[model samples]
Target: MQTPTPSPGQAVLAQVLAMLQPLVVWLLRSGVGYTELTAALKPVFLEAARAELARIGGKQTDSAVSLLSGVHRKDVRAFGQTARAVDVRAQLGKPTPASQVMTRWLASDWPDSLPFSGLERSFEALARAVSKDMHPRALLLELVRLGVVLEEEGQVRLCRQAFVPNPSLEESRRLLAGSVADHIEAGVHNLSASDGKTYLEQSVFADGLSPASVQQLEQLANSLWRDVLAAMVQAAVPLCEQDEPAGGNQRIRLGMFCLSAPMELNAPNNNPPDGDGDAPHAKDTR
Candidate 1:
C-alpha cells in the first residue's frame, strides 16, 4: 500500500485537524458544545485577522476584518463595539479565604501543628479571623480540598505556602484559553519570522527509551525544572513587592511546562542498556 502525496493545502489542512484533535477532546470532556466553541472562536478568529493585517502593514477595517475572518461585517462590527465578556469567578483574586488562611498560618506568631479546636490560637480561631462571612469549618474543608492544608489528630497543618484555590469551572476555562493562546502565539511568531531571529521556543524530545530510562529521564527533567522554577520565582518576588508607579497598564506571564509520556504504545524496543542499569542519567541544570 502506498500513501499518495498531498497538495500543500491538503497537507496544511490535515496538520490543522491533527493539531486540533486534543483540544476538541478536552472541550468535549469539559461539556462544551461545538456551538459554544464556535462562539468563543469568533473573537479569536477576528483578532487573528487583525494581527495578520498589522503584520503586513495593511489597513484593518470592519469590512477588511470580515473578509479576512469569514465573519459577516455586521457581526464583526458588533464584536468590535461590544465589551469582552468577563469571567466573574476570575476576578476574586488573592484575597480569597484560602489564601488568607494559608498566609495567617505562615505568620511568625502562629505555631500549632496539632489539631486545633477551641484553643486561644487554634485552627478555627485563625480561620475565623480571615474567613469573614464563611464558617471556619467551611474554610478548613476548602483548604484541604485545595491541598493548602492537612488535618490529622484533630489539628490542621499548612501543606503548601502558596494558595491555589481549587480551580472552579471558570478558572479552568480561563486557564485553558490563556495558556494555549500564548503557546500558539509563540509558535506562530516563530513560524512567521523571516529574519532568522526567534524567541526562546524549544523542547527536548526523544523516543526509543526503555521504561527504566523513561523514569530516569523524568527524574532528571524534574530536577532541572525545579531549579529553573526556583530561580524564576525568586526573581519574580522582588518585582511583585516593588511599588507600582503610575503608568499605562502592562502585564506579563511566564509559562514553562514539562511532559513525558510514551509516544506510542506497544512499540518494539530494540535497543538495550549497555552500562550498569543503576548508572545515573545525565542531568541538565537548565
Candidate 2:
C-alpha cells in the first residue's frame, strides 16, 4: 500500500507548522500557552474573514463571516460589537520621531558626532528637520535608550551604524515583530497571487559548510547590506518628499536576514531521541 498525497490545504498547514516552529519557541519563552493563543486567534480569524469577504465583494454578514472563518456566529456578532483595535501594520510600520531623525542624519552624510545644540550642524537641527513637533531633547533620550547613540559632554555620537536595539528592550520585540510580519506577508502574497504578480521572496540555501565558512559568509552579507541600505535611503528620501505633498498613502520596507545553524537542526530525525541530539548548538548572532 502507498500513502495518498495530502490535499492542498493539509499540505499548506504542514508547511505553516514548520515555519511556526521558531514562533512556538518564542511563545513558550514568553509564557503564552495554548489557551491564551487560541483565545487571541478567534478575533484574528474573524478579521481575516471580513477582509476576505471585502476582497471578494461578498456580503459581510455574521453568518457569512462565521461560515468562512469557522468562528461561532455568536462570537462573530460579539466581535463586531466591540471597537476594532488599531491596525498592526500602522502601529508597526510608522517610524518614531527618533527613527526619522536618525535616518535624516545617516542620509545627509553629516558628521557622526555633533554637538547637542549649536548654531550649525547640530543634532538639534537634524531632529528639528525630521519633525518640529517633538523636542530634540526627547528624541535624543529615546535614541540613547535604544543604544543607537551616545551622549558625552553635550556631544551626541552615533553608536551603531544600524538601528539595532538591545534584545532585552520592549522596543526590540516590537521591531522584531514588525520585520517578521512584513517578511511573512510578502511570502504569503507570492503564494496566493492570482494576477501573475509576485513580491520579491527568494533566498540562498546551503549546507555541509564548516563554521569558518559560515563566519566569512556572514561578514560578506553584512558588508553587502550596508551598501544596499545607504543607496536605498539616499534614493528614497527625495521620492518620499515628492510624494508627500501629493498625499501618498504607500510605504515600503526592504530587509535582509541571514541564518546559519548546525546542519542537524535543518534535517530533523524521523525517530524520537531519548536525549537531546548530538548536534552542537550555535549561538544566535542576531
Candidate 3:
C-alpha cells in the first residue's frame, strides 16, 4: 500500500501545527485558552489579510479581506478604523536604559571597570554616549538594582557578560514578544515574497543526540553567538550613526537560538551517518 499525499493546504496546515506547538505551550502556561486566542486573533487576521491584498494589488474591501482571511464579513467591517490606524510596533515600548548600557558595554572595547565620572573611558561617558536623555547615575542605579553590575568606590564593575532581566518582569515579556514577532515576520515575508528577496533565517537540525552532547552543543552555540554579536555590533555602530543623520529609515536584527529535545518513541528513525561519519539526515531551513 502506498501513502496518500496531502493537498497544498493540508501540507501547510501540518507545518503550521508543528510551528504552533511552542506558542501553544506558552499560551497554556500563561492561562490563555483557545477562546481568548481566537478572540485576539480576529483583528490580526483582518489586518494581515488587508496587507496581503494591498501587496498583490487586489481590492481591500471588507468582503475581499473576509474572503482572503476566512474571517466573517461583519467582523472585518466592524474592525475599528481607529485601532487599525495605530502602529502596532510602537506599542511594544523602547528598550530600557539599563539594557542599552549593557549592550554597549558588551559590544565596545571599554574596560570591565570604569570610574563614575570622567571625560574619557568612564561609566558616565558610556551611558551618555548611548543616550544623553537619561542621567548616567540613574542608569547605573537601575543596572545595580537588576544585579547586572556593582558600584565599588566610585568604580562600576561589570557583574556579568550578558544582561537578562527577570523572566517574570513585564520588561522581559515585552522583549520576548518583540524578538519573536520580528522573527515570525521575517519568515512570513520570505514565504509571501514573489521577487526572490529573502532574509537569512536558516537553522541546522540534528536528532538522536545524547544529553551530554546536547549540552556541549548548547555551549558551542553560546560561544559562537557571543562572537557574532560583538562583530555585528562593531560593524553596525558607525553605519547607524551615518544613517541616523540621513533619516534612519531601516533597521536590522541578528539573532541565534538553540533547542534540544528527545525524539518520540513512535517517530521514524533518522538516517544514520554514512561511511565518512557524516550524518546523512539534517534539516536545513534557508
Q: Mind giving the per-residue lDDT tens digits that candidate 2 earns over 1-286?
A: 9999999999999999998899999998999988999888888888888888999999989999999989999998888945244568646756778877876776666788999997579999888877789899999999887778999999999976556556687656776788888888888998885878788777766665678989998999988887777788889888987999899988788888888887754454443365654444343221
Writing each residue's lDDT as its tens digit, candidate 3 over 234-260 gives 888789878998898776777787887
Ranking of models by TM-score: 3, 2, 1
Give the lDDT of residue 142 in candidate 2.
91
In terms of lDDT, which candidate is strongest? 2
Q: How close is candidate 2 to the true structure, as a TM-score?
A: 0.85
Query: Candidate 2: misplaced stretches above 4 Å?
Result: 81-86, 106-108, 161-163, 265-286
Each model's lDDT comes to 0.66, 0.81, 0.79
Deviation in Å, model 1, residue 177 alpha carbon: 3.7
Clashing pairs in 2: none
Q: Estimate each model's TM-score.
A: 0.61, 0.85, 0.86
Worst 10 residues of 3 by lDDT: 82-91
Over the stretch 173-216, how does candidate 1's per-residue lDDT look in tens digits?
Answer: 56556756666656767876686866666666666567798888
The local lDDT score (0 to 100) that residue 187 gets in candidate 1 is: 73
